[model samples]
Target: MKTRIQELRKQHKLSQEELALAVGVTRQTITSLEVEKYTASLVLAYKIAKYFDLTIEDVFDFSELEEI
Candidate 1:
């Protein structure tokens, strides 16, 4: 999955560690999300999006994925 985590984080002037702290995850987890090496679960995605004051679709690009 592709995410706008880095972009949003920069726009918010937040470091990966800060974002992780705000969202209750590890810095490595945030790094993994930024690199698309990890796909977030529904709850995690919700938490991240909410932390950014954005919808999940705003943070994550799901248009390329086929419907399950």
Candidate 2:
């Protein structure tokens, strides 16, 4: 899956650690999410999206795999 995490973080001028703190995760988790190395649990994804005032679909896109 691909995400606009990096772009959003930059737009908000927040460091990975700051975002992680806001979303109740570790900095490494944020790094992993930004690089697409980790798939968040439903709760975690919701927390992140809520922190940004966005919906899960607005932050992460899985439509590319819809055909599969």
Candidate 3:
């Protein structure tokens, strides 16, 4: 899955560790998400979206999954 996480982080001037800390995950998990190496669980996804003050759909792209 492609994500705008890196873009958002840059715009917000947040490091991976900062974002991870805010969202209650490891920096590695944030890196994995940015690199599309991991798909977040529902709880994690919600936490991430909430941290950015966005809805799940705003933070995550479900279009690709829909195509399948």
- lDDT of all predictions: 0.95, 0.92, 0.91
Model 1 lowest lDDT segment of ten: 59-68
Task: Kindly report which residue pairs in candidate 1 clash with one another.
Answer: none
Question: Candidate 1, residues 1-68: lDDT per residue as tens digits?
Answer: 99999999999999999999998999999999999999999999999999989999999999778665
Tens-digit lDDT track for model 2 on 12-58? 99999999999899999999999999998889989988888999999
Task: List model 3 lDDT by residue over 22-66, tens digit each.
Answer: 988899999999999999999998988888898989888899999
RMSD of 2: 0.9
Which scores greater on lDDT, model 1 or model 2? 1
| Superposed Cα RMSD, model 3 | 0.8
Q: List the residue pairs that clash in candidate 3.
A: none
- Report the alpha-carbon TM-score of model 2 versus the true structure: 0.93
Predicted structure 3: lDDT: 0.91
For model 2, what is the error of residue 49's alpha carbon versus the real structure, in angstroms, after optimal superposition? 0.7
TM-score of each: 0.93, 0.93, 0.93
Query: Model 2, 55: alpha-carbon shift in Å?
Result: 0.6
For model 2, give the 10-residue run with minimal summed lDDT.
59-68
